[model samples]
Target: MNPFNKSTGRVVLGGAGWSRQIVTDPTSKPVLQTILHALSLGIRAFDTSPYYDPSEILLGAAFSDPALTSKYPRSDLLLLTKCGRITANDFDYSPAAIRASVRRSLDRFSTTYLDVVFTHDVEFVSREEALGAVKTLFEMRDEGYIKHVGISGYPPAVLADIAVEIRQKLGKPVDVVQTYCHMNIQNTTLQRSLGRFYGDAGVGIVLNASPICMGLLRKGGVPIGELGDFHPAPRGLREAAAKAADWVEGQGENMASLALRYAVGTFASVDEKGLGVTILGGGSIEEITENVETVKKMLKMEDNSVEALDLRDYSLFDEEAYKKDEPLFKGVRDILGEWIDYTWDSPDAAFLEEREKRKNQEK
Candidate 1:
């Protein structure tokens, strides 16, 4: 049986957005409230990372709170996090660094073991280093510090190829693989690679993150505040996204909502058992509520269903509403045109060269 088949695991609550809040305040009440509200709505899986600075701390506090622990025990929740990528321009895949990072995450989360611990953004490091990190994680798994080992990165093809290599060298398949931006509206490359992940690599779970392309597909354009400047999309993609957002708004629709629904619907429809899980992040309770509602609508759950009724108190989602938005979704895709499936180089060429230079110096 698929371990993630439970409703709670279908949509994972991502912790990166929480890290954005950490920039202004050490602990954010709004983030905590949003998390508590998500729990009340039956969200059980959470994805975080040490690199997402204090995300693990904030989530740890909430998870340890009496109000939360009383109702939801540690065993009932799925805690997923990552290691290796330490900062924006820094990455350490050394076995010692990987082990230290995992221990730190465990300390921050106040938990004995993480449900999943990925070698965050493996593409940034050398292939030998990436495999070494995964092997180190496997060792921790055997030692009972981690339940599963995985990898998360931007390039689906690179990630898929690594998964295959891990299986061949390590003698066992990775437990999970996560790729962001590739499964969203503008790019469906992750969908094309799903067969490779499942059939060739024997991956157990494939997670799709950044359904809205890290806010690029939204109406206001890529957010320009604290967490906005870090977006790596080039001018061409950004301009195309703006046009798509404009067209979507002209039709009296929200670009982000439509994109979210499209992504969830597409992934859920990949196969009978579902080919992927979506990792989503929201800065507020309203946004989180809307995200969960979109998931309910995409899965075609009944209006009177428990999860739906909890989130549907304010907005109603039904087949008629979903069908009405299809054309607008198509229009946005049409506007995207040439930018469709376009992938920008992550850790761009300059950074890769600089990183290699630094590694050589260390040697």
Candidate 2:
């Protein structure tokens, strides 16, 4: 069966927003409101990870609420979740561990089957471990536990390589892939590497998250508390982003909204036929409203005077349309020229140090 044949919507409601008190707090009205509102906005997919605290349970409860059950039942939504890389310092790719993780996720989400299950953040682990996780997920797929199986990671090159490796070892293509921060305005690695993932590696659908690149592209900057000390990007990139945000505001547009528009707009407008989904995290009802509005504008622009070109407009394989329409953003790209496509290390040095400590203890 074609993996993309199902009703996987173009936009997915991200569960990262519910990671902390939003999900942990049982009476969080905002969480329920956001999910209901998202369903109203035509978002039929939800992406969550076990590592994201109680997100899975929170989403499950929200979907099963009596007020929403009949109007938007579990059957109405496409459930997507991930396993492996449990925390910054914890990662388990063993077959038995992965199998157990999936079962626990099923319980947490209160679902019989998952629409998709991804091996989260495969770059930090060894190839053998990563492939083992994918193999087990594929096994789960065959067992009728998951409809589609795939992997997600930060590095496009690493994700592409692993997708190809999985196809070679398992004799089937990866059904989906989730990569964040790569398709945003500052970094377009996902766009540049689309051909490799779609053609060479055989990824059926691609999901892009963090249109604002984890708040680095927010006005001022990402608060140190929100992302902690290991926030990845260099100080220079952060500073440049702040300046760009101010520059964008001077042009009378919200920086975060503009970034969202560019990322969501380009992907939704492009008629490539290859399925793509943008995962957006919403904290409150207003945030969900803003996201839905951004998507509406994205769709409207195609019929309006924007004359936005289709994905075909980009030469043979490139998907970075921001560079092509650099003139529209009023030199924001020029201001960030020094940091374009610049990526800091993921599973940062601190994470790596803890990884070694864990290994030593295990040994």
Measured against the true structure, the TM-scores of the candidates, in listed sequence, are 0.91, 0.87
Candidate 1 local lDDT, 1-363, one digit each (tens): 134654445778888776752344436446567788998877788998888877778887777677787877888788999999988889899999999999988887788999999999999888899999999999999999999899999999999999999999889888989899998889988877888888889998899999999888898776554453778888988998998888888878788888998887777667324544788867678988888877766664434445444422322224465576688777888888898999989779889888789879999
Task: Write down the lDDT that model 2 would get.
Answer: 0.74
| Global lDDT of each candidate | 0.81, 0.74
Please list the residue runs of candidate 2 whose C-alpha ends up more than 4 Å from where it truly belongs after superposition: 1-8, 21-29, 223-230, 268-274, 301-326, 357-363
- Tens-digit lDDT track of model 2 for 1-363: 234433444667788777652333433546677777777666778889887766777776776677777786677678888999676678899999899989988887677899889898989899999988998998898898999897998988878888988888888898888898987778877776677778877778878888788777778676343335545788899889988998888877788888886777566544254444678867667887787666545543223434533221112212354444446554777889989889877767887888789889999
Error of 2 at 31 (Å): 1.6
TM-score of model number 1: 0.91
Q: How well does candidate 1 score on lDDT at residue 146?
A: 93
The candidate maximizing lDDT is 1
Error of 2 at 231 (Å): 2.2
Identify the runs in model 1 with alpha carbons over 4 angstroms from their true place: 21-26, 225-228, 271-275, 302-324
Measured with C-alpha atoms, the lDDT of residue 180 in candidate 1 is 96
* Candidate 1 worst ten-residue window by lDDT: 308-317
C-alpha root-mean-square deviation, each candidate: 3.1, 4.9
